[model samples]
Target: MQKQKTGIRHMFTGTLPQVVASLTGTISAVNDGMHYGWSAPIIPILQSDDTPIRISKTDESWLETMYLIGGIAGLPVTIYLVDKIGRKNSTIVSSCTSLLSWILIALAPNVACLYVARFLSGLAGDMAFVATPMYVAEIADQKIRGLLSSLIYLMMLFGILLIYLIAPFTPFYVPSIVGSLLLITQLASFSFMPKSPYYLLSKNKVDSARKALDRLRTTKNNEAELEDISRAIERQKKEKGRPQDLLLVKSNRKALIVMTVLNAAQHFCGISVMLMNMHSILTEAGSVYLKSTTTAIIFSVCMLTAATFSSFFVDKYGRKFLLITSSSLTGICLLVLAIYFNLKTVGYDVRSVSWIPIACVMAYAAVFKIGLGMVPIVISAELFSNRVKAMGMTIADAMYLIFGLLSIELYKGLSESYGYHVPFYLFSALSLVTTVFTIVIVPETKGKTLEEIQMLLKGEKPVCSNDDDATDNLTQA
Candidate 1:
């Protein structure tokens, strides 16, 4: 018989605790996705005469833009507490806050309460985005890190897909009720898991960190490699990860530039605007696909399929490869979409191939998940030192929110002034720029350990290139 499969590499399949941590963490992402999909289907309902909170187009715009502002508001709070309180507790609090936001939405009697609730939910979304990845990255075995990192996006896609499927048919309040229940489940499931071993080790709780590592590892106690992990942490202790250091140090600066640029580029590509407002664009496309909710469902399904693929293949394929491919294809699809919209607006009578816009959106969603959506997120996690990871990630997360705001605002303004094709053309150009940047600069971190990643980010000699013996080189570096 072949040698029995047993070690960190099998944490996704063969280890119990690692599986538990990932599942518990991903459950919260459904809440994040619901926050996204909430506005898309409900916007029409709120704008119609049959609503409880009657308002103008301005209020409706606020409902969408407030989420981005809330994301911005949440960064300072997360930065203050993430390292101080531990990733597990911060995550638990994020779940509770998100639940409250939904509950507030359920109980809203006026527009003011709804606005407050949306902002709170935005805060919760950003917190989850910042904390969940850090916790998972720290606790996960290097072999399975790529897969687990992709889970946050996957779960968020499921949440978006969930709302699209159910909310359009149900009463206005039902979606909020169901989202609240999901958050409750995540809170309960997550309370049982341990904090990040890196966090614990940083806090000088060596025994606790070791126990956390043992639980995450498949081999009993992970007895042989535990000491090596402790040693790697010791090496990282020399790198004081203050916020200013992230900007000043050459290696840290390089990683920051790459991380910051990738995060901003993702939003400039116009995915979030498409995500929330795709149905409206579909309706305007004047296709048979717009007759029912099928178009929305298909687009969502395409995204889920792509995110699922990334959840499996990101590690095998590596970050830079996927980023370049995803960015390139996304640019082409956006260009096609721009031309399609322009032709239709000019009375070109292209109903013979009305399917082009829908097909482009679906293809764009699928290819985006494989790389642009997943790689920046995973690579950013690898760039920061543990000492200032909260700050580094908070800055990255903030840029995502700020750029998202610009994307949404720009789409609305440009469409109002010059037609929808303008934003599409602009995003396509940005995607091309992103593709070239990926080829020239983004470093690969497919199988590297966290310490090895930190070393690489610091512009020091890389400790380990592959996950197998990368840790053993930490001391040498």
Candidate 2:
């Protein structure tokens, strides 16, 4: 019985990689819609006198602020509901809300309606960030947990790439319409998507969790898996605690600190800001629209490489090494770009300039996707036990989305006022700081169980009854 239980747990390691993959379909549609809409037809739509909607500088500022405000407002509610409703159900609701937002944005008659649409989108965005990774981590076995968590970022990169592809050719309404349609599809199909068995067990729905476990696993040993899940649930019930309580505990405090710092650092890495304003950055570098579009494609291609390679290596290399290496690489690239900007400011004028900055930016994006871009999401979910998973993720995401708002606002204003290179330099300095933190704080969870990882984080030795051989695979490459 014990051996079979261990074997069933081992299956979770294999299940890790599939977690983020589940959301790819939804991610690709919404992400493309949001980014592509902003860069492509929306601009023309807003600028046209014939159009019913017109966006002034004031309108743009208000729209952005509304989105940020919505995120701040939604986090607490999402945290509460996820615990009450379960991961799968929460996602279905959020995705549906997002679908409605897209439709509203597409059919909006005035600036007021657009703000409401964006606000709704912001709510869904916050939900996705918190719920998706949490769902992935809860379902994943420890061995490849980091790799599984990375799927969100991988899917996100694909989302961004799809946007770049569709933006240049499609009409303004096309992306939003597509996003809405995809949302409908997701809502319809989610009936088939199983709820997180972990959540079920947490709620004492043991029979249901077992059924979900069976469906997700789809292998032999149903009785053994049920026993293992029951044991895990028993352990969790002993630790039954609130998110705030766990965060205040001495051992869990360290996990909180590490996760918080890492989450902040992920955004501070600057790739996100750059992505949000890719066209504007290219324009500053003297690239016209056509050239800017070409540069976006190149950047996306490089990012895709980083995403693919990271997915392959995350399980092999562990999280810490990849994070440190990627941070160092990103920092160096930012510093170089800073130098380029300094030269330009000092009066180096020539047309048909080298595309060095563009290339460097692409490389930086790729490196980020491999490490920092994906690590925070996984870490946040893993930091707490099931009792507090939703809340922990909620707090982490709240901080993340709040910082995200600041980052975007700062990027928009600072790029216009201080200079492009300055933001890169700032982000580079942040990356260095984050690298130091990663080395000193973050632990490797490659091939480790959630309980084992929690124990490891608490400075206790984790005893794995099954898959002792798997530990050998966790060493950094």
Candidate 3:
């Protein structure tokens, strides 16, 4: 009993530093969430009688597209920054940009100012997504890496929920003020966290890398782990990090394909469209029992809750299982929603089933977050070797933004031309396609070390079960 108790206590102590570092770094995601979710509540107000700046439907769509355009623009900058400045500094830069964006939003004089502010926010969000995952993945213990990595999406969901809760009732500028304050808080707190050991080692600062690793791990003796990291870094450095390597190298090619498909599946499911236009969709549904704002709040809350629960299961259940299940269930929900919207569009008296949209959307929030919404972020961080990680992630992120931009536009164009059912049906079909893709293409990565994942990506069996073997494999590879 005493031995068992000691083991449990040691396990808890070992994970504490990792947890703290992850929380501090990922807190920036809350601000990203706020910026992403900001559109949902504010767009309706922009079209209302008490609007500060007048906006037509075209202008509103531009607001969303501009953010995505900015995200695409930021990808090249992020690829450069994450490698040149290191992950921690990159995140700090992201925080500063996010703060500036909120300030601009808070003090905007015209629609152009609003567009520019959103563009900056998108840039910051892209930076955070690229840098924070690498930082967290490099610092975390493999045993809990999935959970720690999932914190990125979990924090994002919290931010979304936060904005959803406040934006409807508060004044136009209140959410921006709150978002700015949170970014400041992240800057202050995360500034004290150590740089990623991988980044430090890549720069040939062995002593600094050791110190950073020490700060992230509870055990005083991390020499073995340090050596393992050094070996891996050395192996990766032997390969040229050219952009062509992302496709020329077999493993890199595989990782890119997997990520491209995953990103496509993630965005084509209409999550961005659903989130950005939730209030409008609900209002159009004509729900007699609840207001659109209230339903939006509930939608965000359900997403957050589902994401929170998913973090606990990611490592245990494995990434492939959760993704397949989430994708399958999400398609079903979307299909149901498509049917309901189609029925309403066909001049049917859907008044008797008015509550279906709410139920479908709420259920979609839960099922989607359980896997499809969160796992890709985690997997993207794990897939690439250090050689092409930055470039690979940037390309994947660009794909994510592009797909998002296209999906949102598809929603707007299809809905305006045909009806809401058209877009929903398209989203539902894409989601089903995603399910098949995950079942065949996406590899299971739960509980694997960075080295093991690379080996798996290379089509080699992972024989290393411990740090010593991982070091041997790195040296031999």
Assess the local accuracy of residue 314 in candidate 3 as a C-alpha lDDT between 0 and 100: 82
lDDT of each: 0.82, 0.70, 0.86
lDDT, model 2, position 90: 74
Compare candidates 2 and 3 on lDDT and give the better one. Answer: 3
Clashes per model (N, Cα, C within 3 A): 0, 2, 0
* Residue-level lDDT tens digits of model 3 in 340-441: 889888888989888988898899999999999999999888999998999999899999988887888888999999998888888888888888988887
Candidate no. 3 TM-score: 0.91
Model 3 Cα displacement at 280 (Å)?
4.4
lDDT of 1 at 92: 86
Looking at model 3, the pairs that clash are none
lDDT of 3 at 215: 89
Off by over 4 Å in 1: 1-13, 221-224, 342-349, 467-477
Q: Which stretches of candidate 2 lie over 4 Å from their true place?
A: 1-41, 49-52, 222-225, 283-290, 347-353, 408-420, 465-468, 471-477
The deviation in Å at residue 122 for candidate 1 is: 0.7
